[model samples]
Target: MWSYVGKKSNPRWLWHAIDHRSGKVLAYVFGRRKDEVFLQLKELLEPFGISRFYTDGWGAYERHLEALKHEVGKQNMQKIESKHINLRTRIKRLVRKTICFSKTIQMHDIVIGLFINRYEFEVSI
Candidate 1:
């Protein structure tokens, strides 16, 4: 999903990877919705040894993930989609602070990363 820093035209995307079986967020990265950004998220997921990937036919996924390992369409993306809703609703409701209303990229990533690390992964960092 995308959010703007100061203006709508400058969108920063939150790329996520969800565990298919558990429906838990494995990792996420905040940056432009470009291949390099997606690559960063993919790199973070390397240790999981993910066998297959499901995406909404995003070009970056197709370009990086092999055809056999990658599946297009929203066939098994419901969990991830649900997570999106939760992030939007819960954050907006719970953190009506500078985090959600961030005007800078550094603050945006730091706050959201902290929240995700603490709540999503059950760890404090």
Candidate 2:
């Protein structure tokens, strides 16, 4: 799944893949909302051996994942959507119209990445 960041005109997308059953974020990438970005996330998730993918009917998912392994609907994607809400509440940068936002693309990704790593994955910097 992808979420927007930065200014509207010069927005960046944060792409993340989560394990449906575990509700744990498996991998995340920061980039534009394009096929290349989704591909990068998919590549990162290769080691996990993902058998099924639940998404919000994005075109990229249709192109990338096999039809049988992919299911599109809000019902199956509730966990990830909930995570987005949690992230927006916890991370000010993710909230729309927030004054406290990263000025640069690199910083934006770095801050969110650090937060996810430290809090979500429990990895020490």
Candidate 3:
């Protein structure tokens, strides 16, 4: 999910990814959808030793995880897509898309990342 900040002269992109089962953020990258962003996401998830990954047909993800020998498949990707819906529904700032919210991509990504981490903990308890 993404939105533009009409009021801000500069716009940023925010990206977050979570483990659907745990509802925990495995990685979050704040930047343009470039090779560097892909690398950062991989770096963040390396500690988890993720052997399998499911994602939409995103070229960046293909470049990043494929090289790491992570199995990427299209089938059952709905689980991850569902996570996106869950995140958006819980984050009012994301739902509102107000002018003041998510002025920068990095900020939005970090916020969402933190929220996922917090939300997962809350859900378990």
- Top model number, TM-score: 2
List, residue by residue over 1-125, the lDDT tens digit for candidate 2.
Answer: 33344566777888888888889999999989899989999999999999998888879999999999998898887888888998899988788877887778888888889999998899987
Cα TM-score per model: 0.89, 0.93, 0.65
Task: Tell me the number of clashing residue pairs for each predicted model.
Answer: 0, 0, 2
Q: Model 2 lDDT vs. the true structure?
A: 0.85
lDDT of 1 by residue, 2-54 (tens): 77665567677888898999987899999998999989999999999999998
- Candidate 2 at 110: error in angstroms? 0.5
Which segments of model 3 are wrong by more than 4 Å?
7-13, 20-23, 67-74, 96-100, 104-110, 121-125
Q: Candidate 1 versus the native: TM-score?
A: 0.89
**How far in Å is the alpha carbon of 103 misplaced in model 2?**
0.9
What's the lDDT for candidate 3? 0.62
lDDT (0 to 1) per candidate:
0.81, 0.85, 0.62
User: Which runs in model 1 stand beyond 4 Å of their true positions?
Assistant: 93-100
Ranking by lDDT: 2, 1, 3
Per-residue lDDT tens digits for candidate 3, residues 39-67, read 77778888987776766667877766665
